[model samples]
Target: MTLALSVDGLSVWYGEERAVHSVALEVPVGKVLALIGETGSGKSSVALAAARLLPPRARMEGRVLVAGEEMSALSGAQLRRLRGEKVGFVTQDALAGLNPVMRVGRQIAEVFQFHRNLNRRESAARAVESIEQVRIPEPAAVARLYPHQLSGGMRQRIMIAIALALRPPVVIADEPTTALDVSTQADILRLVRELCAELGTGILWITHDMGVVAEVADLVAVMYAGRIVEHGHAASVFDRQQHPYTRALLRTLHDMRAGQPGDPLFQIEGQPPSLNTVITGCPFHPRCPMATSLCATEEPVSQRFGGLEGTESGLVACHHLGDQAGAMT
Candidate 1:
């Protein structure tokens, strides 16, 4: 079967300011691939590209395939169908995603009406069912309320309800649980996991939280300076990360110390270069402690270490993966 989502040699730019640099990834059916990066790392840019959701001024290169259809090459009408029925997208800010003037129910009902060509009455019933599926109480009443009338978590559930209602083959969830409380966040995460396990929907999960990634991701990709620096199985990347950027990120994960209270967090030196900044050699060399003279002037190609069924190696773009591997053993 064709992959649910395939992004190859994809580059994105906003008026010559690069947002994504030749990033490539795939999310197969029933799997979750999480993109982890700090702010402005271009994780969201890649996610949006999966549905051809980039801003009007943003020029995109390469091709995006959604369940075997080339998204970038599609006509406007075709793109709309792909976005509406083939891939469901959930944004981080539910309030922003929802129109304040539109009642939540009518908004979700639009999916059934537009995609499935259901009549108003039928669509309305399905809309309520969608709400109930996400475990929102008082579905009918909740649907009648405007987006602002609902709590943050409730609004997010509505977003998920809308996305899952159509049973899209691929789901791009861009930090869907970032704004919710811990308990509510866990509920949403569990819902997404269950969807993947039971429904066979491939998911591209974009978030900055490693905890969230650990909870939901089967595969993990680390992005830095608009490019994927490393990608591999979650277990492999977490237990034995290869890229210096990946290692630095893992080292900074908060831990429960045996006796020490409030350990000072490890911080990576320097900040990520701006999108317009001219980066020579490795973009990460400026802040990476393991950088050498060679790293300062040469870009490293991705090298594989290990993958699923042992066919794909954990891929890393770093000058010292070999030395890092030796040191680990």
Candidate 2:
């Protein structure tokens, strides 16, 4: 399969603290791979590392390739060109990601002018086209307004338009719909899934929402405390979760569905380990209900597992994967 983005043993550290550890991920063309975990699980760090957008204080190891081009090998100008041409990024917050002073149309038009080297009029026209591509109505009129003038959903659509303006091979969306209302979130999700498929763009979608994964992801990677504990096809991962953390997360989803009003929200016990904390054995052992003494003293390597014949196989890292009582419904 042709991959739009590949990360091999990618690790990120901020001084003495490590945010990501030997994480590997792949985003194949025309598919969505949701990198999922709770806050501080290093999902965002992996995204930043993949895009070479990590902060100056962060040190990175391993390799990242976008559209078959190695990021570390590219020069400064080449790296900039690579970002503009090969990869697109949609940040979590639209208002923060966008320029408050610039008109939305001009912001998108600059992408065309800088990367595609289109003339002023050409770029302006293309900006409207990009906006319309995201399903925004009256694109030309909306394009002329500043980011602040638009509604939350429209601002998010603007961010998506900017990200996809160049039709880059790979797109990274970091929780782009977290702030939107239920109906607006559904619209945004559908818009992104349709646009990426039409353009044959591979998307690395970072989110904590399993519901979102069920809606849009073709594949899923479960991250916990800076490491990937599970990786597999979305259907396989959801239907037959093999790791304790994965089961816990899915249980929350089940509870949300089966619960009554004012019921206490289901949550995984214990907070995720801090980046500065030294972790021996499995990073999730402290919080994992299925963890044993072996889990506390020794790390579990990934193993292949499948639910039924002809199903897509997946990787899970858990010492007690065999114990399957009360499997997530």
Candidate 3:
């Protein structure tokens, strides 16, 4: 499959604070790569960096390639053009993303105005179409409503409508269903997956939900602190987890044993270290149960597991994979 987005040694800093560290990954055309991690794990930071939407205080390094172009090197104008035309983002908070004062239709129409060069009438028609495409009932009526008028799920669908309005080659959805109810979350995930598949759009889905990851992700990248700790086929990573952090995350999801009392929910002990602090070893070592002297002093390089290359699939960063089962205490 052709690579839609490639990130190499990508790092980001907020003034003097480092938020992302040497993160690398690839998203192939028509694939869903779920960037999974808890809060402050740098998942959303990676997405924002890819879209060139980071705040002015952020200083970036390394490469972010979108459809073969070096995104990190693009001029401001070029980045804006690329962002709406080639890559679209549905942010975690739908309410914050939309303009509360503008009618939803006008907001959707703006996509056509900016990217498609459509006149007022044409853009209005297209906006209605976009609204319908997202399965909003009575598109015309809904179009006239402002952001504050819609339910959380409806607002999120509107966000999706705007995102897919341009048919961009890549889409980044950060915590796409965070505030919705469970039923609504399921519907939103289904809509996102179906739409992306139909459009053959590469999707970078950033979320902390393991259930959502299992449902929609083709591949998974587990982030810890500011780095990718494990990445692989979703099934492989969830079913045959290699990294201790990854294993700990999955173990928290359900009872590992069917009949017996399942292990207690394993919580990583400490808070994520401050970004301003200089990390000398595995950032997760402080919270990890299996931490050894080596873990405290040395950061493990990402290596292929399940017999594959780093770029191909099945990658992990940890010192004791061979001893994982026994390491969990």
lDDT score for residue 80 of model 1: 84
lDDT for 123 (candidate 1)? 99
lDDT by residue for model 1 (117-154), tens: 99999999999999998888789989899988988878
| TM-score, prediction 2 | 0.92
lDDT for model 1, on a 0 to 1 scale?
0.82
What TM-score fits each model?
A: 0.92, 0.92, 0.91
Cα RMSD (angstroms) for every candidate in the order listed: 3.2, 3.1, 4.2
Error of 3 at 81 (Å): 1.5
Worst 10 residues of 3 by lDDT: 256-265
Q: Per-residue lDDT of 60-154 in model 2, one digit per residue for the tens?
A: 99888887878866657777877857878888777988999999999999999999889999999999999999988999999899988999999
Give candidate 2's error at residue 323 in angstroms: 4.9
Residues 1-329, model 3: lDDT tens digits: 57778899999999888889999988888888999876788888999988888889898898988778778778778778777778889898998899999999999998899888999889999999999988889999999999999999999899989888888888888865347655677688778888888988888988656777788888999998899999888888887787878877887666322322322223455677877877878888888888999999999998776555333358888888667646543
Error of 3 at 128 (Å): 1.1
The Cα RMSD of model 1 versus the native structure comes to 3.2
